[model samples]
Target chain A: MTRFVVSVHIVPRQGLLDPQGKAVADSLRTLGFAGVRDVHVGRHVVLELDAADAASAERAVREMCSHLLANPVTEDFELAGVRPA
Target chain B: MKVGVVSFPGSNCDEDALLAIVERLHESAVLLWHKDHDLQGADVVILPGGFSYGDYLRSGAIARFSPIMQEVVAHARRGGPVIGFCNGFQIACEAGLLPGALLRNVSLQFRSMPVTLRVETSQTVFTNAATAGARLTMPIAHGDGRFTADADTLTRLESEGQVVFRYVNAAGEPTEAANPNGSMRNIAGVCNPGGTVVGMMPHPERALEPLLGSTDGLVLFESLLASVKA
Candidate 1:
């Protein structure tokens, strides 16, 4: 088995309302960062696992995302990185 | 009728629900622990409100996995009435017993105030006692109460008349100004397609007595009793 480090990024699904993201965007613009556009806020989750290979680790992380890490109704998730630790 | 109240580690409204059921509604009520799988033969199951699992990893995210939830899901699947209020609403959606997700309030603050809710339908066991278009005052207290769902789901809910309650003004108009948390379409409550599973962001159990400044919430309890009796 190989030790792997994984990074998961979750964001509100496109077209879903994200009040937190909107609030941050408004605050940024007020702070003189006018170039910022469509600012969206989300969650980043990191996990450490022992799996047979990178493919296996990625698959496990994906399952985790569907089960708990992200809510399909209002949020989407991406498995950002899976690497040997 | 026997009512079962599920209590999670951080649930604060279990006692209130019990008191309301036994004292006000005159029904036998029991507390089901999160780790317990048995429901004690409750005809109706209620998931009371509070910061379950400390609201970690999002509200209701963790509590959905409790051992008792399996029984609750089975109970609802068997067509038993199940009502989830406030944090319980979040748990129900997370558990896939209901549609939509509750996001942070548009104002991003923990809103704790009495708001007017218009009964959109009187067909379900939960709202059968309320007249169509009747407005009732209920207290809402939550930071994440803005309910959102995909357009398709929202359309389906609207078409099926599954929308049980909507935030409204005193005159029962669903205007934007009356929306407390910016929920889409001012939706305050919704039931599943079967109408056996219900979820709402407001605390009906909190407003059941006259001393609490409103007796409108008792209508929901009364409706439940009426349904169970019939």
Candidate 2:
């Protein structure tokens, strides 16, 4: 299987509010966790793909990010890694 | 008029903003790299839209620390005009040039669509050419376009007339959907207390050309032209 390292951050676009992130931080407090302030939630996606090269793989995933994987308005993604299996 | 467009790494709309200023508006402008600390005789500095520094840490968080931003802050403090659109707006906030932080939308979706903005104040150079009730149609593409501010800050912005634009309906009524992002008080744009620095989430450059659909954004440039020409 082809192994690739793809780091993606599900950040809020300009002017959007992140209630989920706020909720998570609040939950951590209820779990007896203190000193947790200004908590922001993000994502990391790692995939194994058999593609032609890194550029092509990134292009595919970027397209996926633009259309399927992520929302262009509220979130953004950067894709990398495509090696032969 | 000499204009400069700051291009931070990963800036996708620097070219679009430049074309609007130089080509459409028939003004001279340069593409300034983020590392450059010099303004190079540029009268107006534009921080264009698009994800900068790959939106690492925050949308405009990492970019705020860029060397070019230091110059921008200094220029604005010197009574020079500075405009930050979308991601650029985020950087301005991160740099403390403006107030509030951009957060995720309530919908939690990447929203790319047209929006309506009502000009709240026209005293600044950016809106000097327009009537107080001018309406603009522009595109907003971002996940963190939601504007958030504390109650005290919001009150101060309102009392001081720092807010310049608010999302409105086609008939000029304020609405929630018109905001696109769940911004605090439906703020789409704001200016510094000095009115030299303005930041907004809408892409006015995208609306400059009628061929692109709406030309409402051109008036913003026209307003700047009329002011800076003085």
Candidate 3:
């Protein structure tokens, strides 16, 4: 078994109303950044655990996202990366 | 009928819910701790509003895994009545007791105020006593209260009459100004397809007394009692 660090990114699903993200985008535009078309603020979670390999680690984290970390109705989750801890 | 109010860690409204049942409704009630494995034989369960698990990893997410929730879910699956208020609504959604999710308020503010709701349906166990189209005044205190679902689910919920309450104006019109949280279609409450599980962002327990600014919330408890009796 190897100790692996997994990073997961959970974001509000596309096309849904993200008020916090919109507020931040508006603030950025107010600060003179015109290229900001949209912003969807989300959560980044990092986890370290033992797994047989990177594939199993990623799979486990994906299950975690689906089951607990990310809300299927309002958010989408992606495994950002997996590295040896 | 005996009602059980689940008291999750960080739950602030459990007492209010209990009082609503015991003091106002004149019914027996019990507080079921989140870690408990039993419902204590409660006929109905209430997930009262509060920042469960400190709202970490989203409201109600962690609380969904509480040991008591297993029994609650089993009870709900057996067609037992369950109601979720405010943060409880978030928890119910996370628990999949009800469809859709409650998102951050569109205003990006924690709105603590009284809002008007129109009873969209009276068929659910929670709203059976309310007349369809009846206007109710209740308090909503939350930062994440927006009700959202995919377009297909939204269409289905409306077609199937699962939407139980709607934010409305003084005249009972569902207008933009009346929507407190920018919930889709001004939805303030909804029920499961079986009508056994209900969830709403407003705090009915807090509105049960005239001293609390309104007795409109009493009707909800009355409805539940009526359903149980029938």
Candidate 4:
């Protein structure tokens, strides 16, 4: 079995309001970090599993995102990348 | 009629909801664990408030996958009544049984107080007891109760009369000062397109008894009973 390391990034949908992200952005400005605009908060999930192949692995991770990892109503998820570890 | 209250590991309001259903509503209520897949033949399903799954990774993000949610979603799809309060509201939205999402309070504080809610419409199973424009008092307790949705979805919900409740003043006017969570359009509660599923951030179950200083929350349960009988 090939062990694959999958990366999932979940972000609040663009149109939805993000209070936490706004807080962070404001805090960054106070710390002298300039040019930070429109900051958004999101979750990064990593999964290690065995799959038949890369195609199967991608499919499995995609299911996980829709079914559990990410909420479609408020959040959007991306299969950032997958690699063999 | 039987009411099913689904309890997750961190659901602290399950017992309160049970008491409200059995003692005040005088209806048979069952406790369905999150791990269990069966709904126990409940005529109505309620996802009571509380920090389910410790509010980890996001409120209701993890608990939405609980086995019983599958049945709850199916129940709503079949035109059965389903009500979600607070954290339960978050789960319902996460499960796609309802539209929009509960965002963090703009103030970033855990707000716990009674607020006036205007009945936007009594056309659904959950709000049938109130007159269309009547105002009711209910308590809201949460740090992430701001309702947000895309412009198209928001317009659709408004045009479809799916917005069941809105934060309002004692005079029954939706005012910016009365909105505690900065929710879009001062929205306090909403229902699915089919009108069978509901999700609200306020804790109506917490305000049902007079000893708790108010009885305005009872109307929702009463409406449910009335709808079930009809």
Local distance difference test scores for all models: 0.93, 0.82, 0.94, 0.90
The sequence of per-residue lDDT tens digits that candidate 4 reaches over residues B1-230 is 89999999999889988888999889999999999999999999999899998999878988888999999988998999999999999989888888888888988889999999999989899898889999889899999999988889999999999999999988888898999999999999999887788899998899877888789999998999899989
**Global Cα lDDT for candidate 2:** 0.82
Candidate 1 global lDDT: 0.93
Model 1, residue A50: distance off in Å is 1.1
> Model 4, residue A23: displacement in angstroms?
1.1
User: What is the lDDT, from 0 to 100, of the residue B33 in candidate 1?
Assistant: 95
Off by more than 4 A, model 3: none
**Residue lDDT tens for model 2, A23-64:** 888889999888888576656666555556666666666775
TM of each candidate vs. truth: 0.98, 0.76, 0.99, 0.93
lDDT of 1 by residue, A48-77 (tens): 999999999999999999999898888889
Candidate 1 residue-wise lDDT at B107: 88
Every model: iRMSD: 0.8, 9.5, 0.5, 1.6
**Evaluated with lDDT, which candidate comes out highest?**
3
Q: A1-85, model 4: which lDDT tens digit per residue?
A: 7999999999988867778899999999999998889799899999999999988999999998887787767789999899986
Q: In model 4, state the lDDT of residue A24.
A: 94
Best by DockQ: 3
Interface RMSD of 4: 1.6
